[model samples]
Target: MEAKDDPAIIGDSEFTALLNAARQQDPEAMLQLIELFKADILRLSKVIYMPEEDVVSEIVLEFLEFVQQGKE
Candidate 1:
């Protein structure tokens, strides 16, 4: 299923809050945000022929690092 079709994804307001919290380096929010999009990320990775485990790990780490950097 597409990301847009995923019922588990947060609504706009909650998404906005999550983004804000992530930018502030809230680890829990960052994790929640990642989990929220995990399926979509995996789907995209598969479409591009990337190994699921490696790609997902790389993406999640990169995202977390990016968010952490923004707070520095």
Candidate 2:
């Protein structure tokens, strides 16, 4: 995992705030959330034999859609 992804690097409350902010369409928060999960994303992508960039894009798109749905 990347240094930023390490749970110990951030407090639980802070992480929760980050997640909430991302759901609100805060770009920086979304990017931070992506950084936090990037290692797992890459690992999953490798298992499916797809390109890493494509997997990343797909996941981000799906996440954004999920957030949008929550607002409806």
Candidate 3:
């Protein structure tokens, strides 16, 4: 496991494994994935939406809906 405040990590395989583990609901993996993508997701949410700003919760919910719908 990584330190709680390790700040940054760099490695494709490590990140890929982290993502895979997150899909399995490993808490640490989830946290890591969130930490990694939170900024990116927010940026994407902003770009995809209208002039109205998006809150964090809304961004997450929108992303969830998009992903869920895509899986169907």
Question: Which candidate number maximizes lDDT?
Answer: 1
Candidate 1 per-residue lDDT over residues 3-61, each given as its tens digit: 56666766899987888899887889988989887777887778666678888888888
Which regions in candidate 1 have their CA more than 4 angstroms from the true location? 1-7, 65-72
- Compared with the true structure, all predictions reach lDDT values of 0.79, 0.74, 0.62
Q: What is the lDDT of candidate 3?
A: 0.62
lDDT of 2 at 58: 86
**lDDT (10s digit) by residue, model 2, range 7-48:** 636778997788788878799988887787777777777766
TM-score of each model, in listed order: 0.66, 0.69, 0.50
**Candidate 1: what lDDT?**
0.79
Ranking by lDDT: 1, 2, 3
Report the lDDT of model 3 for residue 38.
75
lDDT of 3 by residue, 1-72 (tens): 665765666588997687666566567876676677676666676666554355666766664444334421
Cα error, candidate 3, residue 27 (Å) = 1.2
lDDT of 2: 0.74
Q: Give the higher-TM-score candidate: 1 or 2.
A: 2
